[model samples]
Target: MELCFFDQVKAQPLWVQILLVVGTISILKFSFAVLNWVYVTFLRPGKNLKKYGSWALVTGPTDGIGKSFAFQLARKGLNLVLVGRNPDKLKEVSDGIQAKFGKVQIKSVVVDFSGDLTEGIRKIEEAIEGLDIGVLINNVGISYPYARFFHEVDEQLLKNLIQINVEGTTKVTQAVLPGMVKRKKGAIVNIGSGAAIVIPSDPLYAVYAATKAYIDQFSRCLYVEYKKSGIDVQCQVPLYVATKMASIKRSSFLVPSTDGYARAAMRWIGYEPRCTPYWPHSLLWALVHMLPEYAVDAWRLQFCLAVRKKGQLKDSRKKE
Candidate 1:
């Protein structure tokens, strides 16, 4: 059999022999990648979160992904420190979680990311003092309300994008890092976006995409810096979830609800430094990368333009 295999390869033309070898290697690599993804996404058991600590702190916990994460963490029996801008909304979420997870302790911290972050971060530090906060979820972020040209972005809108998305995440992580470092056991999950990682560009939403790019790099660096310290840092990049931020009101197979996304996210913590937790989002990420960058850029630009046109029309009607 070995002799026959050698003879068959020797009999083939040079190009055919090269093609056969290349094809075999490609197939093996692809198969291995698929198996790895399947194991990580489904078969692998998640780390026992309580081992990191007894409490989890989540920013922007009043609504959307942050809110969903707060509830999920509570379900895991981890006490929660819920931070958000709105006191009333924070109370509402705290009450809701308390009603269901009666044994879980919940503390509410009001931090307006777009406002004075020094004070906001101080509040966070004060709230977590002397508590064993093992998990920190930097989920508070904002994006363009509607796609617009970079030049069309107003001064205030631009400021808020940088403030809330980039600066806010950075400061919150800073406030929590010392505690985790002292304990030498923690997990920090920063919510990122596909605009920065999966796609080549985000077209008109330039500032939002740029801020998320910062998050991706920040998480990667922290992951490397703290790996030996027994702290896990990750940046989770999701495509679109049915959230108010995305203006996606309904969930579909491709677009998970906030709850569904958070559940998937929980399984991925303390693992990869960067990931797309939702399985469908991973599929989309693969597809997007398979295409040429220019093709994806053109498609994204067109899509954003349509969204902007619709938003403009709605604004005009409201004014009239």
Candidate 2:
């Protein structure tokens, strides 16, 4: 008697049956991933900021992504505590936020991340005293003046990068976390870089990437530790934005303006341990990961070399 197709399939080797089952599961998993991506990218509702807290503190709020975060958070009806190295810039941002958002309260704190962090953190702690700060944007960070080999990095730049990026973030988070723990509701958003996450390796920006990688881990650990405490910790990784730090003077579809990036970033807060907020940047990240490791390394090397060349020229012109 001839076996029917279903009987034949059942009678196949156990390994073959296992392979079929695994293949079906893998396909389903991929489909679900796509659907989830679509939902998050376009359809998911953002959490209400007021649910987290009445006030938000933003570091490095004088310019770039930090400044945009301050403005966006103010628009969301949350009061602002603006922290930056420049007192004048901080005051200006505070005044601007107050001017536009009439009912929103604003405070400015000037603390240079690269200076005496103990003193700066004390100032921050004092400034937020008695205030219910529900959101903390650990956005203060520094990068290379321009891409250069690790061996070529200047001593001052090296120290500043570590101090400002790693130490500053850690200390500021420490300052705000106790209050969040007490209230059992808060959000911490650490600004990270795609150089650390997307690329196979960031060739010349070694120190910068390492510091951001630390932030990614730091945020993840805190996320797990604080989940039960009603606190959310997230690291937002962005490839590039049209900001002075990135040396990108113009915004494009891929590289959004600071305001554009911040607007999307605010929507993602209190959601994921790690996220690439801009949809286009997320697509770029996916594409980068699809390429071969060697190809990615080669591309990164070329890109960093170009950055180094431009930086050297700019320095020479400045010296003249």
Top model by TM-score, which number?
1
Per-residue lDDT tens digits of candidate 1, residues 1-320? 99999999999999999999999999999999999999999998988999999999999898899999999999999999999999999999999999999999999988889898999999999999999999999999888889999999999999999999899999899999999999999999999999889999999999999999999999999999999999999999999999999999999999999999999999999999999999999999999889999999999999999999998998899999
Instruction: List the RMSD of every prediction in angstroms.
Output: 1.3, 2.1
* Candidate 1 residue spans exceeding 4 A from truth: 10-18
Clashes of each: 0, 0
TM-score of each: 0.97, 0.96
Kindly report which residue stretches of model 2 are placed more than 4 angstroms away from their true locations once superposed. Answer: 1-5, 11-15
**What would the per-residue lDDT of candidate 2 be over residues 1-320, giving only the tens digit for each residue?**
35686688799999999998899999999999999999987889889988888999999999999999999999999998888889888888888888999899988888988888999999999999998999999999999989999999989999999999999999999999999999999999999999898887999999999999999999999999999999999999999999999989999999999999999998899999999999999999889978999999998899899999999999999999
Model 1: which residue pairs collide?
Answer: none
Global Cα lDDT for candidate 1: 0.95
Error of 2 at 293 (Å): 1.4
